[model samples]
Target: MKKKRPSLQDVANQVGVTKMTISRYLRDTSQVSTALRSKIAIALDKLGYIPNRAPEILSNATSKAIGVLLPSLTNQVFAEVLRGIESVTDSHGYQTMLAHYGYSSEREEFRLASLLSYNIDGLILSERLHTERTLKMIEVAGIPVVEIMDSSSPCIDLAVGFNNHDAAYQITKEILKSGHSKPVYLGARHDERTIIRLQGYEQAMREFGLEPRNICTDRPSSYSLGCELLKEALRRYPDTDSIFCTNDDIAIGAAFECQRQKLRIPNDMAIAGFHGHDIGQSMEPKLTSVLTPREEIGKVAAQRLLARLRGETVTPKILDLGFTLLYGDSI
Candidate 1:
């Protein structure tokens, strides 16, 4: 037979305390004397007792937990966002439950349903668009939710992000102003953000009386993909004077390929990337890119959620932290 799981009563019995005392101690350490607290702590460790939170959640009590959903786990951008969120959640004694949905609205709906079952106090979502069922679940749960990374979309409750379209448009205008008229947009993943960035690029190109050119792929963004896209761009649009990549991963990769082909930066071709990563700055001809306030967005999103949870009024349902253009040698 399988060994039985330890219970609160087992812990109480081992610590020579009533179950109510154990429950009080679990709820708040201040309720128990220091000596008893130490005994209970040791008993909990020894018996491997896990306090079931289902009872507390079923009673409509706060779970003291926040659910965070990300589209990608390997992306460093989300990693930085997670770091910023944890910095705030950790100090406030709240736990974070993370789920990855791989940029699928359907997968996001599934992951969110699982998280809601835990009765989390609030939610932090990476994407603005959600499935209808996901929206219904959030409405019924009636919990605070903050969507990050794009402010242009209609949010369920609150949003924290910079304007993606404007950021791309501004950068594209800068490229044109610098005399790179025939710039091509290199996009990957074809995600919502990527498509928005492409649209921004197209808008700028059209405004300048130049046709927009795009060399895109459905594959996830990577350094190798960047190299391949650059080769294909040169082959297809041989007269292309500049390359504007969706993100630094592709930009840096294209830069390396340029070097391999004996092309001079900005002379033979100008390149710009989005999401100012440290690696971009470290490149020989530092990459000119749009610097997103990713960490700040995460920190502010967590702050807003926590504020709402505390019954504090959070003004401006949509918060645009904004973006900056990093003027480096690559552009």
Candidate 2:
């Protein structure tokens, strides 16, 4: 037989106090004397007693926890966002429950259902699109929700992000202005954001009286994928003068490929990437790219969710933090 877990009564017995006193102390220490509070704390620690929060959640209907959903855990972008969100949640005595959905709507729905079952007070989602069932679940939960990373789409409740389309458009326009007329749009993952960036590139190319050339894949974005996309771009568009990548991973990959082929940066091929990753900045010919406010978006999203939870009205509902263009020597 397994040893039994310590309970409230066990702690009360160890502290020589009534079980009700122990329960009251656990709930609120203000009602209990300081001496007794110290004693109870000691006893609880000694017994290794763990309080079950299920009952408390059922009683109060608030778990003091926030649920955050991301498409990828290994992505450094999401990691920065998580750091920003936790900075706010940790200080406010709120716990964060994280879930990864692998960029799949069905998986997101499944993960969201599991999170909702825990009675989380609020939710922060990285993706704007959701399954119908997922939408229904959120409606029923009636909790504050924040959709992040893209302000172009309509949100369910609240949103905090920059415009992906405009950022891509601006970057592409810059590349064109620099006299790289035969620029190729290189993309991987084929996700919503990737597609939006493509649209921006196409718009810029059209405005310049040039046709958009693209080499894309549904494969997840990676440095290796970038190399592959670069090879394909060069094969199809031999005259490709510049490469505007969907993200830094691809941009860096393409840059490395150019170096391997003994191609000179900006002379043989000009390369640009989105998201000003540290590695991209550290490259020999630093990558020219769009620097999105990822961490700030996360911090602001958490703040808005918390404000809503605190019964404070969040104005405008949609927040556009904007982006910056990093003019590295690559482009």
C-alpha TM-scores of all predictions = 0.94, 0.95
For model 2, which pairs clash?
none
Highest lDDT: which candidate? 1
Count of clashing residue pairs in every prediction: 0, 0
Q: For residues 1-331, could you state the per-residue lDDT of candidate 2 as single tens digits?
A: 9778999889989989899999999878988999998999899889998888999788866898999999999899999999999999999988999999988999999999999989999999998878999999999999999999998889999999999999999999989998889999998777889899999999999999999999988888899888899989989988999999999999998888998989899988999999899999999899999999889988999999999999999988889999999999987
After superposition, the stretches of candidate 2 with alpha carbons farther than 4 Å from their true spots are: 1-3
Worst 10 residues of 1 by lDDT: 48-57
Cα miss at 5, model 2 (Å)?
A: 3.0
